[model samples]
Target: MSEISREILSVGDLNRAIASSLEERFDAVWVSGEISNFKAYDSGHWYFSLKDEEGQIRCVMFRGRNGQVGFVPQSGDLVEVGASLGLYVPRGDIQLTIQTLRRAGMGGLYEAFLKLKARLAKEGLFDLERKREIPAHPRSIGIITSLQAAALKDVLSTLARRAPHIPIVIYPTLVQGPEAPSGIVAALKSAAKENAVDVILLVRGGGSIEDLWAFNDEQLAYAIAQSPIPIVSGVGHETDTTIADFVADLRAPTPTGAAELAAPRRDQMLQELAAIEQALSQRIHQRVEREAQTLDQFALRLSHALPNPERMREQIQHWQQRLKQAWLVRVDSWSRNQSHYAQQLEMLNPQRTLERGYAVVLNAKTGLQAVRNPDELNTHSAFEIRLADGVANVKFAELESRKS
Candidate 1:
């Protein structure tokens, strides 16, 4: 027997070595392909396979990283993912750990969308002022799409659940391919000419931009704008915006949303009616209370203003007695004031001052001269002193300076 020397490695060790080597070489790479076998776990992790025409690779978008993707991906949808190549250590399966994901081939369609949008906007087809308001309660609703479309079921279901009384008019037409544009235009003309439905709904399930390009027809846009009846465009998912959305009377994110917009829920209408009845009842009650209060006030005012012969006589007697008392009080006050003023005048009399031992002196040359100091007097200076009722002339016997 010949013994063969070989290197024996554990499965864990081999997987780890392969993972490390893959991460080192394929760090930060982009992979583009159609999505398949997509499954979203309750843990918020996304598991799918990215496959091209030739081959496919299993992929995972973890909860933490997948939240950044703007649109929800579907099977058969073309997408591009940026990821790192890794090996699932538990299963030793080769897989890609996705970091970012976005719809593939959107750039060209987005550019075309922008250009068409600009052209239509310049033509005033997208003017908000011209967009008709969707009727709050439509009598009949018209739907334009393929008879076999999945969206038809959703719309019918929602409308039945919300408002079963409303009538649904479905006009079968081609919603894809080159023939779709003319088909949609013919449907619009038919609906408009019939005038049976109050509003029309153009709805379809979500699809890639290429599949939805039929709705972007320039002629279809003009037809929608020219339609007399209001049109609600609910094509594609919420994130998907088509040219018809701008030209339609209203834009809804989904087919069910468009149906809801078409008719009002019966239960909600009943609730609103109940609310209005309650409000009106309360208003009437308040008005009655206010009027009652006003009547009471008026009654009180009338009672006060009304005259009784006996009460008028009593009032007149009371006023006459009060006037007499007031006049007596006024006379007494005047008498007291006169006595006080007379006493004050008597005290100011000059004779009374003289009697009180104050004398008035005057210079003989200048009568009643104001001599502020004794220096005003001199030897042989004649003076007059007024005493009570008499005036006396006097002469100084000697001149003396007390301080000088």
Candidate 2:
């Protein structure tokens, strides 16, 4: 026999050899099995094993382009995995690297649901603390649901009854199926971008868990949690609890319940206002009556203190007389002092003396009072002789001074 050619393979060659063996021996195909020993890493990678009642095969759903599908897988879940059988180079162990997963009996969607819920819960998307409080008086309320949904009609009717003036902004969206989650998320994002609403109502009519699965999506839950405005989740009946409900600021049993929570009843508020007005009016009337009684008491006391009207009139007359006497006395004393001062002032007046037959002669040019002595007088100068009634301007032809 020809000596078998010894094949010395490098490490890469060994890995390729094992890879080729796995590729050829087990074709890339689909297998349905129950998930077992599912494990996820912090690096966003998944490792799990799928097994039947008697057999088991290791599998991995990597963090590749279809990583979002991994978000819904869980242990003990029945899943159909599409993968290629591969061998690990180190241990030369054969395993299936899962490219995709589907629900074994119910289809892949069910597995996807559980996976997304787990992922979102791990990220704190469903934390109550992360939720915001709905506005007590939202100016405009946005509704995210199908327009044809009965929930929309209920919401409209409730709002019309409660707060008709509040505006409503409706964004039509799918509430079911594979595309529902994305559609709902987009609707929420659009509402946020428009920013016309103070609060958003994510509502849907009563439905089965499958029908309301879109609201349970991890992406939808996160969107509700991350929304800047408060979200009121009203999905399904009162007994149903969805991820959106858990993450929303407020959860209503029905769409009408959401409308009621978002606004105050118009008639109720008006009644309250009317009650307040009536209370205020009653208080004012009481106050006025008390004041009027007080005024009446004051008038009665005044009347009693003066008993007879004639006596009161006499007292008023007496006071008036005393005031007149005091004022007259002051006026008389002021008049007498004024007269005495006037007489003294007249006695000191040179004009008064001149009126009593005295004359004042002054030199005209020098403007000096003329003296009796001739030597003190200037001859051939103009002079002013002031009399009581008139002043005479004269020229002195000769100085005639008399020594008196």
- Residue range with the least summed lDDT across 10 consecutive positions in model 2: 364-373
What is the lDDT of every predicted structure here?
0.81, 0.76
Collision pairs in model 1: none
- Candidate 1 TM-score to native: 0.55
Q: Give the best candidate by lDDT.
A: 1
Full-model lDDT, candidate 2: 0.76
lDDT of 1 by residue, 123-203 (tens): 999999999989998878888988778998898789878976566777779888899999999999999888989999999
Tell me how candidate 1 scores on lDDT.
Answer: 0.81
Candidate 2, 64-93: lDDT as tens digits: 734657345656667777889987777666
Off by over 4 Å in 1: 1-107, 308-404
The TM-score between candidate 2 and the true structure equals 0.45
